[model samples]
Target chain A: MSHAIVAPVVLPALVAAFVVMAARFDLVLQRTLSIAGTLTLLGLALHLFLLAGDGVPRPYLLGAWPAPFGIVLVLDRLTATMLVLAQVLAIAVLLYAVGGWDRQGRHFHALFQFQLMGVNGAFLTGDIFNLFVFFEVLLIASYGLFLHGAGAARLVAGFKYVTVNLVASTLFLFAVGTIYAVTGTLNMADLAVKSAQLGPEQSGLLRTGVALLLLVFSVKAALVPLHLWLPGTYGVACAPVAALFAIMTKVGAYAILRVHLLVFGGDDLPTAGLAEPWLVPAAIATLLLGTLGLLAARTVQRLAAFSVIASMGTLLLALAMPGPAATAATLYYLLHSTVAAAALFLLADLLAERRGAVRDGIVAAPGFPQLDLLAGGFLLGAVATTGLPPLSGFLGKVWILEVVRAHPAWPWLWTALLVTSLLGLLAFARAGSLLFWKPAALPAPVDPQPQARPVLPLVATGGLLALPVLLALFAGPIGRALEASAAQLHDRRGYVEAVLGPGRSAAMVER
Target chain B: MELLFASGVGVLTAVGVYLCLRARTFPVVLGLSFLSYAVNLFLFASGRLVVARPPIVGPAAPGYTDPLPQALVLTAIVISFGMTALVVVLALRGFLEAGTDHVDGREPDREGRS
Candidate 1:
């Protein structure tokens, strides 16, 4: 299974090519191949997770090339955890899409397969420049998917999305060039060693590079000042695309943790604690904006979009501090928020169809079919999203609160956390009563058309909504796994030696 | 030489940012291209400038430029090229669909234009 490290990246890439080249003529064939490839990827991801469970960082050198001289894909607990989470989200989103979304857009399945290939590659790559390549891979596929079943609104929004990401990519190259100039290598582990040992003159340039890198990642994470792109982009996307996009923001958070924490994190490094000053205040602002925007949102889709920003706010807040407790909480909250946000988006789409003219707007509509089932799903998703009790959101919030109690700005953090949770609860409750309760109390309007809602998409939404409950039930084991992942993440020396080998022989690769 | 190269990058970036802030998609697309050009130049020079040296590793070579930046620059150029093509097509689509070239897809008022 030594090759399992590469399977998550390689398998989907090959599958994407075959889907385009062989199955291009038939939709049925494309769906079958795409779904089968995803399920197999799930199995490979799980096997790799078990492999990484021993707390060892396994670096797979491509083409038998030595470290620092060739590209390496490192499989560790952190990468494996992300892979499993991504695949699970992909399956649910795919199921929901096939219920009819893929039919609306040409080449959805092919683009989807390529998207998975890129996400998996991004998670596995050990070289910084390779990560840029994977980011472009995923972003390009996403641009196509973002405009799937294109409309005027979507095309306009897609323009801005593409432009924003293009700018971010340019900044990414600028940062990488600066770092390469100083460190002379783009291998992350080697950079960690070289950057830490740099003299003061080089330290200034390195910090500037690190700061620019932070900007690019934050744009992806949707942190404040750079988060203007999220609401517009996610709100207008097709539901399943938005659902899959739940992990996209998490990719940004993952890069921050991987690069900022492990590569240039320690006291000896020039860039140590660089993200700390910016993360806390900006995260809180992001959370505040999300809460206020929730009440102001006209469409439930926009509401869900803002909720993503808020959830990232909480995740990034935990990310501000790097300890076993905080990092573990960050990881768990990351999982819960992604599943919960996806559930909200799917539920919004379902409601959109039933409401007809209102089409996902918060205004009340007459009773629609399966109101009770849909209502229940909304309530569960809301509970999870608003951090209410008896679900994973509340659990994650409690963990975060405990860990952040030691921060210098604990009072501001607590007030922001508590106030936002209350307001979010109120927003959801008001939206629910208007959409579900008021409609139920009123008579069912005489309808021009009342189509029987498909059962498959409902089942998919219900399955995603149920994950929060499952996460709560299995909190102990999942919590332990994340704790171990956090420990592995913080132990920089272990990661460095794992990638570069003992005696640090990467210098020999130099000309 | 350093001052010239640094100022060149700075000026390209300044122009890029200025055009990017314009209210039309055409300017934004052009700005993105300019920004990419600046970045490509910056990446090419990251290994430091050298003259009359081969990049290969051989005993006869008196000196060598860093070959890695060349590789990096090549990759950056290809990606940026593809990205520019995609964005231009997208901007064209937006203009066709919305029937306006404004970045926000709405025509500006006469008063605002003035």
Candidate 2:
């Protein structure tokens, strides 16, 4: 069972190394190895999910060292859920990349595998420093992936992305250093215990450190005033890579949720409720920025990027509120937004491929072949992104609204969400009509060249588009599971006890 | 001694932030490198700057330095080194491809459209 917890990280690392060493030049072998590795990871994620569903937080201590000393990997319901989401998206993006996208750049397959390894490690690791290492692993891989096709625009965007993140990484290290200086521990559970026992002066320093940490995560989450790098970066990235990046922001959200709720959540601690004051207003501003960006975007890819930002805003708004209901709503909305954003990116790529010179620009160009299929995909994606009815987007938003209705900030939250949804609807409607409804007046080409759409790419994208549909269908069981996970998250005592043993956390509290 | 280290870190970070806000690629990369050095020092100092003490545990030793921060700083130094190298390469690539070193990839518009 412990091995299962490690498998997701280990398998990808091994496969990535093998691909670099043995299958460097063999595209076929690399593809086979990559796919097989991701499939195995998906299987392991599902297995871990089942094991975690029993409500036990399983902690795997490395080298048999006890808590606070060893590197640990915890497989709780939240981690398992994240692992499955990441693997599912990885497999989908890998399938799409296999349709000649991987050949566009060197080391694409290896970098993709390393990226998965980083993400999985981030989700599983129980120590904060390990989280930083995994974050770098994933970030470095993302940098390589972002520049895969290597255009001038991509190069420039990649430069900005690297610079911004380097600064953020520095801040992360500084924050970690401060926390360690004050508390002398980096393990999450130990920090939980130590933080609660801090004296007044120590509490002030710890609060500063915790605040810095939250700022670092906010940058990763692309909260407004820090989101300038996202649109440009995602806009210039290739379609499949952009699709994979949908989950990257969610990784930041997960860090905030996990660290904030677990380490700084004690009622008597000065750091308790630290994030709430800042997160809500910034999240609302982010929503506004996203909506305005969507309205002004001239291309499908940029519009899709803005929608991603908007969805992140929605997720963070729920997260700012402290309750199991809000956490559950955030998780459900997170799942829906990730899938919808990825599908939109892929669909934009498909449209770009078909339109040739127009390349997904929001202009009425002559309709290309496979019009029906492309139109249907775009419509479904548009509906999902705009949070229209009969999709998980709608369900997730309704759930969040319902959960936030009783909060003191309910009026502002409700207005921002509803107004933004309306604005998003208008933007998508305009984009859809311009791209699909308006018929161009150009005559048919005399050459009559027949372009064949690859069956595999379509299948890959179709599979992603089907997710929101499936989410809505199984919302009952999934909602229940998320509620249970959120309850477990809120029950910080259980987590501390699980990792530190039954009496240890209680003993610390007594002292 | 601690005051000197703190001021050094502060100066490095301030200069780094200033350079990072510049509109060119090379300066920005250099700034990031400087900021990383400052952070590394900060991490090292987190162990409380013990002097004349061994890092290893010894039965006869009076007191030893906290070895964990050393380990962390070593890992952090290696990671930051790699990061700096990667950024330098990326900046060079951007310069080569875009025919300019401006971080925004183009000359600023007369109307300030960026």
Best by lDDT: 1
lDDT of 1 by residue, B1-114 (tens): 888998999999999999899999999999999999999999989999888899987898888999999999999999999999998999999999999999888898888751
Model 1 stretches with alpha carbons more than 4 Å out: A447-452, A505-511, B111-114
Report the alpha-carbon TM-score of model 1 versus the true structure.
0.98
Candidate 2 chain A worst ten-residue window by lDDT: A439-448
TM-scores for all predictions: 0.98, 0.98
Model 1 lDDT tens row, A1-511: 2988999888888988998899888989888998899999999999999999999999999998988999999999999999999999999999899889999978899899889988999999999999999999999999999999999999999999999999999999999999999999989889888986788989999999999999999999999989999999999999999999999999999999999987878767779889999999999999999899898888889999999999999999999975778999999999999999999999999999877888999988888877898899999999999999999999999999988897998988999999999999999999999999999678878964766667878888999999999999999999999999999998877888889888673332211
lDDT of 2 by residue, A1-511 (tens): 3688888989999999999999999999999999999999999999999999999898998878998898998889999999999999999999999988999999999999999999999999889999999999999999999999899999999999988888989999999999999999999988888887788978889999999999989888889988998999888899999999999999999999999977786676678899988999999999999999999999999999999999999999999887889999999999999999999998899888888788999998886878778889988898888899999999999999998886797998999999999999999999988987774455543554796668888998999999999999999999999999998888777888999888767634421
In model 1 chain A, which range of ten residues has the least summed lDDT? A502-511
The global Cα lDDT (0 to 1) of model 2 is 0.91
Residue B69 in candidate 1, Cα distance off native in Å: 1.0
For model 2, what TM-score is found for chain B?
Answer: 0.92
lDDT of the structure predicted as candidate 1: 0.92
